[model samples]
Target: MNDQTKGIIAWIIIGLIAGLVASLIVGGAGSIIGWLIAGLIGSVVGGFLAQRFDIKLNLGNPFFEQVIVSIVGAIIVLIIAQIIT
Candidate 1:
């Protein structure tokens, strides 16, 4: 696998984990695909919000940091989804 492939895989793993955790925390129902979608969306939104809000989280690990941000973002997405639907 190339660097891009590795990155994609890493992202998928992070997304899946973040989605699962977010769903559990925010209370959501869906399949693996749903979780993945939520996770990916959350990742983007979370990163953007983190930057916009100046949220600084130094977890000492890049991967863990990503997961934490992703989870927080996913929770936000889930909450919005719940309100919308």
Candidate 2:
């Protein structure tokens, strides 16, 4: 697979994981697609926040660190959403 394709697949995987975890934590009753979308958005949010705050996970593995970050972001998004509505 090409680099771009691999990146897309990685993003999707990260999103799915982050979304599911966030749903469980936030008691989400949404659909799979919804979680996926949320997770995707969470990844972006997490990345932005991480960049701004200089957050880094020295877990020796980039993927796992990203998953954690994405999960946190998803949770933040879910919480903010709950408050907004």
Q: Top model by lDDT, which number? A: 1
Candidate 1's residue-wise lDDT over 1-85, tens digit each? 8999999999999999889899998888477987898898899999999999999899899999999999999999999999999
Q: Per-residue lDDT of 1-72 in model 2, one digit per residue for the tens?
A: 899999999999999999999999996738889789879989989988998999988999999999999998
The runs of at least 3 residues in candidate 2 whose Cα sits more than 4 Å from the true structure, single-residue gaps closed, are none
Give the TM-score (vs. native) of candidate 2. 0.93
Q: Per-residue error at 25 for model 2, in Å?
A: 0.5
Cα TM-score of candidate 1: 0.94
TM-score of each: 0.94, 0.93
RMSD of each: 0.9, 1.0
Clashes of each: 0, 0
lDDT of each: 0.91, 0.90
